[model samples]
Target: MATESTMTEARPEGKKLRANVKPAPYRIPQAPPMGWSPTGSKRREWVSRGMVGTIMFLQAVLTLRLRNSPSVGEVHTLTDYRSTPFIQGNESIYPTIVDALGITGARFFSLLCMLACTAMVYSWSRRLFNERVGLAAAFAFAVIAPTLVVGALATVDAFGLALLALATWLTIESRQGPAWPVFLAAPVAALAVVVNYSALYYLPVVTLLALLVSVRVVAPVMAAARTAPLVLVTIGMAAFTASVTSNQKMPESEDIGTLAEGTFHWLGLITGLALAGAGFYVKRARMGEVPRGYDEEPPGIGWRIMLGVILCLPPILAPVFLTLTPSVAPLWKPPLAYSALFTATMAGVGLVRIVGRHFRFPQWGIMAAVALLSIGMAQSSYEYTLWPNASRLAEVLATQVQPTGKYLASDPETINYYLKDKTKPTQWTPTSAGDPTKALKKMTFDLVVLERPFLSKADEALEAELRDSGTYRILNTVPFRLGWTRGTHEIWIANDVPVK
Candidate 1:
């Protein structure tokens, strides 16, 4: 009877264990099921990404179209300084890249650089701050009128600016760790200097600062390694520039004076400063020690004062130098001053962030300030669009002058490009400040074109003498009209001149 009871108890326990067991070929442990809901922040981020992509695509398209337009005119004879090498058919070293690249190639390359720079800036800014700050900086660069105009043409300014933006991005990125990438970027920076000699001045100042930052972040050994490529590339570029400029004659010192005179654009400088100041304030208030919602950092008073002082330096120095030494002063004109202000402001804000504990700012204020500054800059560019009017004058000359007659142009560069291969004139007439009448009298020319603005009182007297000499008669007095401004261009013909 005891054995029977034991069996009954054991059977009940076995049945209970069997009930808990499952029959399967293989058993797999499952991870905790993930929640399916999407957060608001994630959705907003996706939307912002889509918007940025769309905007960039549109900007690229607009820039491409602007570059392709023939109506914009050839950029070859934009300045007299660019005329000599251009007309001489010097292929190895062009005075200005606009002559070398041609319209299409220049435009394409410029657009490419602009887009790349914009993207790099956006990426760097975003990494440092929030998406809003990144967008603001990128948009500010993209919409800047001078940047757009320069980018549309075949000049080196746009390319230089692009390289500058790239260098800044690389330098900032390198601050995070080892700066191997800066070595790769050095060649590009060097190329920028080759393209524009002014970049030599600008790059060194920024590069030194960058190196200091890099050394502080990374070890000294690593910084040196990163800087080695820059040193090599810079040396190579300097050699190349020297070789190209060695054989070329220096432009007349007076011509340099004229260039300096034309470069003064005060409105542009002011706008640049204001924009920079606003950017600095916004960046500091948002990203500095004080959290945006909380008033912890108190607006970085020390940083603001320092930046304000720094921003004023360029403007002050520019005038003093211009007054004391006009030649050197104009060389570092409004553009450089404006660039300095922007750079200093950004640097100040960055310094504030390094010292601050938290980062946040009033988003609306930043956007408003950027938008206002961009609009003002765009308007300023519009106002000064046709300052020299060389291209427009060239177009007029092309239409007015006949193909068979010998024509003498005061601005030989413009005529050479517009009348290339046409049997118009013996190209040796001096239309600059020098006396060209002896040369003019020696050559029997059918027509003579003179840009009145370039003529001094003495030059005008000579022109009048030519007109009154009875050997040549006035054919057309082409008024050099520029958007409500009436300028003058005089055309004359010899009574019995031979066709070329």
Candidate 2:
């Protein structure tokens, strides 16, 4: 004990010893985990905005190029401007919008509509979700093959969808922020209905979305007051549209499936579920626990689940509802043709989450894939421009056949458009009352134009009937290139042609 002198030694040795002791395991600083982050820098916002603009520009250019590709099927805008209430409304709006923009051609009108839709998609998505999700949504809308084809056409579908997007944006804003925006949604909904009769189908889905937001988070009294006007206006528009267009033929139950095919599918369902699940986990993991005083966060998992259900239901119900042949036929027709923005937004969000979480792909990499896939899909249908073959056939008929006669056309819409200047010939499809065979046998046509693969399922026996009928003879069988195959049409001349 005596030998243990309490010496105050020079502390330099202690410092040297501590310095050489390998400070706290020399770990390299770990980088922050990558996932959903609500906050972003101004530079990021600018970059996203630029990307959206670039994508919209690309879509506009492509749409403008396809302006002359020909109109196939029943795009309401392609119909005669004065024939039906829907067509008249579409035509009336077209000139005003074009005049406002100072655009001279129909192509520019289509471009403008497509641009509006793209902008709405980006704006609504970004406001509701994040810039990343919004960018992805815009990218999806830009790159999808069907969206390009439909959006490029001079149809009310794009405009209708644009209005729908606007209404949706307003409704979401009203629920999340101000009460006034909900009132604005009412007028937008009415405009959507006026733009396209098919907008009726979308109304229910949107109402469901509004209810989801309003009932849960918003004040009940305020939500009710805001919602009542929207519902009433929507109903009023639907009734008015039905009354105005009562005479228009309902698209066949079978054809309705074709309209909604792109949106509602098993792949979309699977992808949606994956998206919701992944997003839920990632967000929960990042947020950990609800912060002490943080408000204005992105919607919770419950909202995500509800949204997924909303987006997925239309596609599933479309085919079934159309199959039933409801009395309100317009309501049964697949609504997604004009509601593509919503579908694309849902798809985009899911795709981005999946790519980032599952495959560990960076944002740029995901975008590259989206672009390439879109280009590939669109390019695959290069030669099969809608109605080009039909238009060319119309030209052949004008020069080759005498125009004075009742003509039976496989597709009256195309023939009508191409033959608008010729008044001598009147074209009609097989009558609505009877099968094609019976209808053709009953009525004597000067010319019968039959395209392979009958447009209507009930008209499947048309070719056989034409071949067996002794009153007619095949004058010409014109073959048109349709993608990888050639589609041939038989033009039959009545045996009782007047001798000139």
Choose the strongest candidate by TM-score.
Answer: 2
Which number leads on lDDT?
2
Candidate 2 lDDT, 278-315, residue by residue in tens: 45544552222224333365556776677776765655
Where is model 1 more than 4 Å wrong at Cα? 1-101, 212-216, 231-405, 424-428, 439-443, 497-500
> What TM-score, over all chains together, does every model reach?
0.64, 0.70
Clashing pairs in 2: 264-315
Show model 2 residue runs off by greater than 4 Å. Answer: 1-42, 61-108, 208-218, 241-249, 255-304, 320-339, 355-360, 363-388, 401-406, 424-447, 454-475, 493-500
